[model samples]
Target chain A: GAGVSQSPSNKVTEKGKDVELRCDPISGHTALYWYRQSLGQGLEFLIYFQGNSAPDKSGLPSDRFSAERTGGSVSTLTIQRTQQEDSAVYLCASRAIQGASKAKNIQYFGAGTRLSVL
Target chain B: EDKVVQSPLSLVVHEGDTVTLNCSYEVTNFRSLLWYKQEKKAPTFLFMLTSSGIEKKSGRLSSILDKKELSSILNITATQTGDSAIYLCSQIQGAQKLVFGQGTRLTINP
Candidate 1:
């Protein structure tokens, strides 16, 4: 793909329901990230996956929020027992991990999935 | 805790007017500062500053970083109505994660 792609641009789920968001990063990119953006709020880092290393889940708000990246290409973010506060936009981004070039550190973002838990 | 703060949460200006947005940060192992412009969806990357005192320019948008002050400024010259959007500032930490500011909403009226 030319850029990062996300599935289900919009999702409306009931409280306590589980929701999964998927992301397809650009070809050959080795680093991927997931973030959450609430209404009128900045992007909050959720998890980061680099190659086959263990993901950095330091930013996950709770145990309900879990994510997995398969084959270092596609990634999935699953929110279990969603609450009203979980209503936000979930964004995915990917970056090339190469030399020290500045562009390598730049992240390409997907359109994001807007999750609304009623 | 890593922190990024942006000033003037919101601003309104007439077309052709220039506007400057400010961002300050305090984070460990800061590797770069990035500026992004967001419309309805995800934010698009604008400029990434790694060196202090060097200005990065793109068309009407320009940004400069000052590591000594731990701050950066984005200047938009002769803004247009299409430039109306939210400007976000983020700090890259440990070359892995990004810590972002609350963002500045700029509205340019015709």
Candidate 2:
């Protein structure tokens, strides 16, 4: 794809339900990230994946939130037993590669999936 | 912990006005600072500043990083209605994670 792509632009689920959001990053990109954006809030880093390294899950808010990247391309963010506070836009971004230069830090974002837990 | 902070939570200006957005950060192993313009759901990439005192410009939009102060400023000249959006600043950690600041919402009226 020309840019990062996310599935199910919108999702409405009841509290206690589980929701899975998918992201397909740009071709050949080796780094991917997942973030959460609440109403009137900034992007909250959730997880990061770089090639074969273990994902950095330091930012996951709780045990209910988990994510995995498959083959270093497609990634999935699963929120179990969703609560009202979990309602937000889940964004995915991908960077070309990791390096010491600024160019490697540029991340392209997807349209994001707006999840509403009622 | 790595943190990024942006000032002036929101601003309103008339078209053709110039606006400056500020961002400060305190992060260990800071590799780069980036600016992004988000209108709706997606945030479009703008400038990536690594070296201090060098301004990165894109037409009406320009940005510079001050490594000494651990801050950056994004300047928009002759703004248009289309420039009305949330401007976000983020600091890239050496681990390849980006710590984002609360964005600045800019509204340009015609």
Candidate 3:
């Protein structure tokens, strides 16, 4: 793939409804990441995947937020019983390298899925 | 415990003006700093600064890192309305994970 791609560019769900967001990373990229951005705010780290293992799950905001990656190629972020605060843009990015110094690598980003909790 | 901070939460300027955005970071094992531009949708990569004092330039945009002060600055000279966007700063930690700043909202009026 030329770049990262995401599905359901825009989603509107009622409060407390469960929502699933998907991310398709670039081809052969072994590292993937998920982030959330609220209105007028910065991107907040949500989770990271190195291959099929997630070593850094500390960024998950709460118990309701969870994510899983399969085959080290695609990932899904699931929000169970979503709240109003979950209304934000969920971004995904991938880098070719699995574990490398940040200065030497660059991550390509997806267009992101905008989730609206009504 | 890593964090990035950007200044001037929002700025409005006319086209053809030069603007400089500031970013400061505090993170252990700091590897690189990245600049991105977000316009209405997804963010586009701008530049990445790893070495201190050496400047990276692309057309009208340039950036430099100051590892001594743990900061960086992005400059856009001869700005255009198309340059209007949210400028984001990210301190890369490892591979795909990055700690981002709140972003500097830049609006250029024509």
Report the number of the highest-TM-score candidate: 1
Clashing pairs in 1: none
lDDT of 2 by residue, B1-110 (tens): 77899989999999999999999999666677889999999999999888643579989999988877989999999999999999999988756777899999999999
- Candidate 1 — which residues are off by over 4 angstroms? none
**Which residue pairs clash in candidate 3?**
none
Model 2 chain A — which ten-residue stretch has the worst lDDT? A96-105
Place model 3 in a CAPRI quality band: medium
Model 1 lDDT per residue over A12-110, tens place: 999999999999999999999999999999999988999755458888999999988889899989999999999999999999988668878798899
Q: Candidate 2: which stretches are off by over 4 Å?
A: A98-100
Off by over 4 Å in 3: A98-104, B94-96
Clashing pairs in 2: none
Estimate, for each residue in B8-81, the C-alpha lDDT of model 3 and write its tens digit.
89999999999999999997777778999999767888998876435799999999888889889999999999
Chain B TM, cand. 3: 0.93
lDDT ranking from best candidate downward = 1, 2, 3
- Candidate 3 residue lDDT tens string, A67-99: 999988999999999899999999998887745
Interface RMSD of each: 1.1, 0.9, 2.1
